[model samples]
Target: MKLLLILTALVAALAMPTSAMAAAFVVDDPVDGPGVGDPTDCDGGAPPGNCSLRDAIAAANASPEAANSITFQITALSLTAGPLLLTKPNTVIGQERNTTITWAAGAGPALTLEPTLTGTGSTLRRLVFVRTGGGAAGDPILRIQADGTFFDRGQLRNGPGDGAEVTSVAPATTDNVTFAGSTITGNARNGVRGATGARNLAITNTIFFGNGLKPISLEGAANAGAGAPVGLRVGPRQPDGSLPLSGTATTGGTIELYRGNPFSSASPTLGDSFGVGAGAFSRVPPFALAPGEPLATTLTTGGAGTSEFVLVSVPDDIVSPGLTSVRAINTTQLRMRLSEPIDPATVQAGNFSVEMASRPRAIRSVSVDGGGTEILITTAGGWLEGEAGYLQIGAPGSFADAAGNASLVAGRVRVAAGPGDFTPPRLSNVSVTPKKFCPSGVKRCRGPRGTKVTFTTNEEGRLELAAFKGRKQVGNRSFTKDKAGTYTIKFSGKLRAGRLSAGRYKLRFTMEDEVGNISPAATRTIRALGRKRR
Candidate 1:
């Protein structure tokens, strides 16, 4: 009886269907071959056979086993057709230092993990994805819809869209996606985008640069739905759950911490310390995570950060120095009033210059005034009276403020030549030659053989002499003096031949200074006797 029972039990055990064994697919071909004919086949050697990446993915998806793996041994491969869709829980790993996946332009994502599938132990590691073309506006190099997916040590670059886009669909599942030790750069949009229904996303030890918008963007549906919280811990997370604090750092310009979503009406709540030079490991302001709402953090300029913190250098507040007033202290010196104090060391002769229609004036020196808000510019020569001139100060990067912020643009001031030589010249020693002579007992005095007038001035200027007979005819002489102090001018010959007919005559003298200042005219009257029957 015992032998018969053992025989029946053994038969029953053999009748039961056994679980299918998990299989490993090795992709040896680097070409875009056709899809697989038998999804259960993995031993086919190379291209046109079953060992290509596309066929491997298709075989893994079609396999009846719950767990499977796909690995590559090629140095490089191109995905010429559509994206390799992942419909099953599978681990795709690239050979260390030897595997690269390049997607053609306008093609779909390089890899898309379908939302309909559940990936509890799925992992993607040690791979490089170069998106050459064809990713549309909202497309990404990697699209994830699976739960508990892990991406490690990957490089995604040069894509027309985001590096990765993660979304969770209806069944309201919580997709806990973790990405670590990766680099995403030169993408058209965000480095990583968390679309609506995404949840429990974590990023660590990832470097992002040259992204068109934010490095990380969190978006949700427009309606209010219960979505899983998104937490971003930049750097390594400590065991105590608190971020390690570090010293402050500076940036080239203003660094924005968070941005508002253009698609939704909700605004981002940025912390007070969201500007440039924010410390690494600084606590970012908490914002609402609503459905259809979007939030992002942008890194527009270069900054400093550590492995565990987002340390950004503070940008100096640079304001162009404003010119309030420009005055000429003398012909060659100008005093410029500024809106604020400037750095003394930045003031140099090369930084300040004068320009006119003639040419650029040479800057002899530049100095700061006692008030600290004024700049003194001394030219090689005095300014010409009434000439239009421009005083330019602060060349780009040459001049800075007291806080070390450089002036990005040059500052200019328009000025005119100041009033000059207000004082009029003094004239003296006025005398007329060819004195009238009267013969003793003669009835009328006669004009001398010639008439000469002379004068002296204290300033170097043009001198004029006029000789008039009664209110009618006469002669005039003009001359110029090269130096200040004294000058003389004489006029002779015709008081106009017989024109000075034994009568009274008037002599007028005037002088004009170099700066166009005219002195009062000096006049002298004298009687001339008629020439005796010459």
Candidate 2:
């Protein structure tokens, strides 16, 4: 019964329908709480303003919509109201990177997402959850009892407990979990510890900084235990297919890309602890610590009651290169910096392209400077000074810092005008490429014609697009800039009433600059033809 429910919730939860309406609750107060809170009773919560994180979450829980959102107006909130429990999926979005949600010393985890009939359902964006007091326990900052969740561009730090790292215990196995563009620091134990249950997880563009223990935990109960059959048999693959207890034994865990995460331990038993040294970490059996290497910090050996420590680690550059920063150097060129130096031989001008407002820009050439970490590219006309766009590095296999690993985010990356880019973004060269949107029913076209809109911008900004068919609104999509430039946003022609149908629709583009400047509205028209039944 437990297993079935787990699978059902995980699968259903992953299919978040785009058309489902969402209820939004905005936080007006930063006070943690006055205990008993109810979302539906919006005006009754104590502290009078009627809106708090606890209250907002309560309101979202009662919402029947496919998705609900809780946004904060204030910068910080104390969990004084009590434990935060989410029964339904909700998005807790913060005002900015520094927006914080804090918990008292022994308050337990900052937030708990325990769904009754679903996964630990929620997406937390741009918020920081801090565990204020200490006393190393294994509690995680975010207690993910289930799966099917996303923590994007957020931070989780300062916790002491088994849950020290996000964990899952209810459903023995949870799936479809992702933590992207985020940071986890100053935890007592593992940065991310997986449950014995299926911990199907993915990490992208995440950094683990100054973690008390391993940045990641891969040992199952069997291996993590220090009892007899104690340590994982470590060694290299011998000529006869046998692995001898020595250097380079695949302990069988790959934390492939760990970006600039530094860890240090001061315990002899843990001198050669998990994630002892950063670079790119992978777990293999027994690689001895250097003769004079420090020990007794965070142990990875045989746990406690065990001895003989090994400092198994991989150096930087073993993982693929990633963008650390992007900036425009005057109007003449732009530089995309990488996490590590690359082999100059992989350089190719054709591999890089620029885009503004959702459209691609031309690239005359691209080259890797002597530093090996900077990729300087130029367009025929040089970069537009106020342009807000992004650089599209070559696709997978096009470039590699190390021999085989390709750079991540080769997709579209926003361009940032480094020196002074405060100008309100402007739109130009706007295009509705299919200026006509076609659904599957349109037989006259070579294929079921899908459609997209493209436009260029003078500075980095956000684009909110509203599509209207006849007198009614059909679709709405927001295009967010990575830096600032051109973009080609795909338009799903689905009508507000149902799927796409024969009609003339107008796409309204509203662009907003980084510094709160809104641009003049731009509109494009497209016609959709009915499908030809087979």
Candidate 3:
């Protein structure tokens, strides 16, 4: 029976069509390159540092020619990125509203997801597409020619053309496109339009506002005979925001909509501990990550032979920590309140992004108060009182609860700046101690305290540290510096992953004054030696 089962599995595997084996590409650089590196290796070629989105996509598109069904683990990406093409299925997955794809006037559509030879579509998550300078653009934000394209948790906003529309006006065989949990607003033309020959286009859990002409127009233009959309499915607004097919009827011509997006509910084990006190925290941020290290090594001294209250995350616990509120304490500083205790070491620029008027603000440093309930962030530029903006957190699945359960979903909060001094604190002579870190079992990379964080501030404020290994935020540690001078504190950042790959990490620091005025930012780089030696 076991042999028969094995043979059945083998037959199923043999019957599967030959597509490109799965691959992950970490796009570290912000610049565009053809990605001359080997498709299988993705080493940034003989000259490294040029392998970014284009390069990764180029390599990913070329992967079907290779032998091994390589599941490449890409670990990093750019934070200001652009118009590109995807020939493969579901090539890039960005956090909703957390990842922005901008297109220049001359560049084609911000992105084009072309279907495969067999006519299968792609799925993209949590991405925002827009035009530069907010003027008339020729192409739609996204041009989907595939048959079953599914895009969730994205925003098609502020464009000169349609927010999301068909690839062609004459309909070159595009249909079965679905858009969910997205915002289509402030565009010059229709929010979502369909051209002739399109069929079964659907959108749900979406918002259509301030768009020109019509919110949704499915018919083909007058001149293009029979170019109108064959059918349009507008689903009902989900109460909890789950994407269940509501079986709504199709309306052929044009439809105006002011529908709203859905919000996810809490997991069964999830509960909020609002207004938590600082004394509840028993251990440093890094030690709490439930990486399954020996409890003896990580067990904090709470009681009876090393604390039974081990401040470690339970592996695989599905608690979704949520951001309850985000408000600026001052022009340069913002504080976030959370439902669960977040691991401080994982709070960094790589995990959070700030956007004002569709542009990102440079993050200097982030501070998590001792209890992990409140997060303080210091951004580079200051804003006036009541300036509108947003904060996108945990986009790369970085921040976690005390039980080590990573926040798989990204969340965003609308924020308005508070009144305070616009000038940020001055920072200088920042440094990280000579130490390296790898995962728990890996002996090749080891150094005491992981790495020490030392810096000087001009005024009384807090010392902040945010560490990132490529685009992945590894860890962060923050402490209050009442009266500032030169101070050397041990950085408790875990270079720990399920073991780590040998690579460089960016160590960022900032000084926030008592009023939350933050310095621009100081950066240092440290390397983590995984299995490979430098």
Candidate 4:
């Protein structure tokens, strides 16, 4: 009959959901207290059990659920009894946010998730663990042995040992641990250690500062074949000090660094202790790191510093040359602005080729501007008005930064014929006056004179004026438009018609648009009438 009852209970337990079977054990004592602390009957005991953290853990283990949670009612508590051994899959949460766990000297870990508890998921959150005295060399404030354990929103500080250690006892078992929104600092050893058989560890939104040793340490077997491959993902560090975000490895492992805004992963320089083996470190895309992106690299040997793989806030080295602005220099010439300087050698006719619905304009030549950041492409023929086409830089590595980092995969940009200013600038209100002078009125001098030509342009462009005596050319002057789109040309002394024998001279005025289109020349006749002495 007892056997039948036991079987019936097992069936009922199996039928219940994991949550239904789970129990919540509460610690009511601010000061360490001792009692049986049976989670199911703590309140039933005479005077009610004290229910210390130690008792709560014990009760959680005794529960039959696969997953249990232990909550504390006290705001502050001290653990004089040493490490609380957790032997089951449990979550220990502080009911009152920011509860403090003070560990006395000689106390082991504040909490040790036993390795013997297979297939358990453990979590520690919203609690502060402060060690008052020194313990063993390798003792950690929190030791995790179960797979899929999480440490969230907690602070582990001032410990004489590591802040946390994650490892698996079973040779074949691998534990995955994650730390989020937590602070691990002031520890004598590494803030977090991943020993043998620990893999897939991730730290996100956490801060590790003032730790005596490296912030993170990965220990693997001396023989590469002896241990499992470990992987670590670290988020960007907060601005506290200049302490570099780094990691140390006793064996082979992989580190993935996530970049913040404006930061990128550069080619890693290996440290002295790092070994070069079959698989050396390599970067993907061979380009600059983008903002808020993660870069993964493998380390085949142990090393002390982050030189194995480090991030730098470098000027964008591998960014593909971007076309910042485009303008039609003329009917057959196009100007393109680049975001950064490009190797002039890479600016080839084939590199700036175009394709369109109609026969694309063949690139006659590609040249870089003096600034080295702009490209001028002269086409074989004028582009049709409103023509649509695609402009692309050739394959990868065709263009590179000064640092020699290859550009990103080239991409095509849609190009459309810009509005062509067919209407040429008008040279209206044109006038040319010659100034005559003499030392004395009686002595009339037939020397040089000052000449001024003023005109207005309906549009912006260059203005050119030429003088001709019959078919023989005399002189010419050119003026560029100012910001207000106005032009004036002046000639003085010998620059003007020097000692001209009063005669009929023809003046020609023409306006050339920015696109090299010339307007009809306007002609004006002026007779250089020599002045007489008064």
Candidate 5:
């Protein structure tokens, strides 16, 4: 009977929605107590208003209501005293219609988080953190020690040195801590700093208007360990720092692009662009940009800003070069699928080829799916049918910038088909056409004569060519394929004849497959026939 009763309770617990298990807690009371020494405000005696933020944190830690709550709202509380420390898991929302934390001539920080106490759940929202004190050593304003989750929203500004900040002798031991929807400006040092194990830390939608150092700085660990996987994610504020109207994915989630407006919403258009370094950018899927789908976010100009968007999405059919997919068939062969189909005439080894825009040299052969819309491109020559492959697809403009404009917005991919008997070879055939300077076959023609050199392939894709003029470089071109899966490339902008001395120019064209497979150099000998001078 006891076992039966336990099973009944377990079933009941599973029936409850996750929301019922996790709920947000808000602190709006303004009762003020004594200034530390006074017995009246010693324990919980002080009125809510007089009670310092530290005292409130202690009270929340001891409160049974704080555990299951998602957020702790701290309305208008002053930090006139020293630093306010936290060592638990809870969000403190400040900056409501009333109240704030002030810094009148204090030598310490407005908020300080030490190493010993881990802030499992702690946040400072809607509060004004000021540093009116003088001197270079004027409190860091906000010092976050090792370990814990801290969500510091609201406004963090006007400190002698760095504004509301996170400091540690070594990197902290905390894992999931973040700074969002806050304005950190006019400080001496960097606005944010992450060391040793501040793994998975994020600073989003917060403005670093001005600072002596960069707005954000991260020194990742050199090696990897259980608690030491390293990376830092940052982005400007969204329109408003609140939940989206349509119930979008909340901030602080996996998928970086989903966290910010993919369309560069805050700084939308061509001029307002943000650039990520090769290190950070490399960590993301090469084709991170989504074209058509609501990839662009609308910025809210008024109060605070919030960024809430989805990153990984349902597979959709969108036609754009950027929308690409990859299917890895073991280590021998791979296949790539596209949103739209391409012509079979464009698939090949050297002449014209299609390859992954991210790592162009990573693929071997290209073939359009029997239907055209699907492409069967491979990297491993040994792949066979029935084998599975990895797929990575992106939207238009997601592939090449030279094609100029992009068409699709979002893209999707799945391991559709693999090596089975259907697996195809990486190369079909290679061909090259040489342009004759004197089409008339005349030994000599006009001066400064021009010629057209074209390379055509059955597969539709991109090609990289190296042209040599008798071992000397004539020029090189990276060609993009058209919809028909054919790359009809022309190398122009050259004066192969005229005033130049008469001589035989040996031009060699070497074609290569996406998988770094190269075709023997197809050599073409051209005699720069000269004409009599007037």
Candidate 6:
């Protein structure tokens, strides 16, 4: 009975269908004969009957009941017809370190996986497809239709559609797809294509080279010729003239990175904090400290253990301790230099913190000066100065000491100074006299789009203008100063004639010193004109 079972298995294997082997997983290795049949040995017993790549794929996919089989691994012998096809549900993984599949010149593609997916949950990973032969600019090396999770850490080249495309113009579900660490080069079309309601697709650390279109493109739900509907749509009537919550779909792009602060989330901490010599302390204004400038600055102990001084900035990613310079400037003031120059519009004077290793030695007061370069730090009440401890700074992901630590907020500064002056800029009597379009006591004004407004500050500093219909900033304007701090800019960009919508608009002006500090939002009202033509 056992012999009969073995003979039966052999006969069945010999009688297996040939077309199925051809359309299944086909390999063209010279050693592995280009046929569909189980070899008696791994490499056909060191002869011409070695199992080909295509036969290996067929074996993986063939099940007594399965219409098609799943491919676990394949070792391509060469680039001639090296890529595998997928018309059914399964995964193709390259197993060896140098194992890669290449498509032949004038070949249809490296891999062509059409739709008709069972739409079941399956994961594909650890595979690479290379296009060795040049072809039409728009010819894709790999095309994936319908839906399934496909992950690639591979190389693609020499065509318009070199990478991969997951598109279904027909209304079908293709959700939750992700791509990472892939390089697509010399292509005419985008590397990845998303269509219909394909939401929550994430792409990361993928470099696109020489693609005519955007590296990543989404057709959006509404834009899909026949896909699922998405979002709230009011106007463009559909075929039935019924307003479905689907007019023109759109998709937004966001980057998620495993290395560095590419997402602009948290700032990079401790970026190259090389402590300079004390002599870098003294510098001419427009402080360009020449390299190797010798000066002496010391971190002294008022009493006991060494106290650590740390600095941190606000709105994470602004500056980190490593990227900031904490110079011991006199006993009363410490100058903090930011990693990059900050925009004056986004700065608020009291929004930073300086800390000491000893909580007791934490900063007591912070006085920011103009030019946004220097900060005056005074010891807090709880600060217990020691001889040996060091000081560190921290602020939400903004800045930190050599060792990453959070800096606490102790107290507000008595006054904020300009970058140009240790004394904070002050305004005694400055006025916004409504000129042509303004009416007395009405507060708001309605005038032409390019109406110019003048602001006068008692001291020299930068001025920021903000115009809003309510809380939304419709128009914002800024002007830099040499020594005379005054501004006259048209509230044109933010204030549109059509944006008035028949109501009063709020106007506020803010003043900032060179040191990252800003004054309060000075409030005023301006009546906005309607959208009517003159």
Number of the top TM-score candidate: 4
For candidate 2, write residues 415-442 as lDDT tens digits.
7753454344687777876655567545
lDDT of 1 at 298: 34
- Better candidate by lDDT, 4 or 6: 4
Error of 4 at 327 (Å): 8.7
Over 4 Å off, model 1: 1-21, 33-41, 44-50, 116-119, 221-311, 315-534
**What is the C-alpha local distance difference test score of candidate 4?**
0.59
For each candidate, give its TM-score against the true structure: 0.42, 0.40, 0.36, 0.47, 0.36, 0.38
Off by over 4 Å in 4: 1-24, 33-43, 46-49, 58-69, 87-98, 104-106, 117-125, 132-138, 146-155, 167-186, 197-210, 221-257, 260-340, 350-363, 369-371, 374-534
lDDT of each candidate versus the true structure: 0.59, 0.57, 0.54, 0.59, 0.42, 0.42
lDDT of 3: 0.54
Q: Write the per-residue lDDT of candidate 3 for residues 1-534, one digit (tens) a residue.
A: 999999999999887767534555654544542333334335434255545556566676676632211121333332133456667654545532355555444455666777665535566766676666433464577777776777787788777778777654343556667776677776777777766544666654455567765655656431132122212222111222221111111212221121121111111111111111212121122222222221111111111011011112222333445667677766566777666567787677677888754567888988886246567888875566657689886563456665444555466778766545556778888877675655344555545435566777877888766666544455565689888688887654443233334678776777767655567767788776555466
Task: Identify the runs in model 3 with alpha carbons over 4 angstroms from their true place.
Answer: 1-20, 33-49, 65-83, 90-92, 95-97, 104-106, 133-136, 168-172, 221-534
Instruction: Name the regions of candidate 5 deviating beyond 4 angstroms.
Output: 1-34, 37-49, 58-77, 88-99, 116-119, 134-138, 167-172, 220-534
User: How do the candidates rank by TM-score, highest first?
Assistant: 4, 1, 2, 6, 5, 3
Off by more than 4 A, model 6: 1-84, 91-93, 96-98, 117-124, 169-186, 197-212, 222-255, 258-534
lDDT of 1 at 418: 50
Winner of 3 and 6 under lDDT: 3
Error of 5 at 322 (Å): 25
List clashing residue pairs in candidate 4.
none
Using lDDT as the measure, the top candidate is: 1
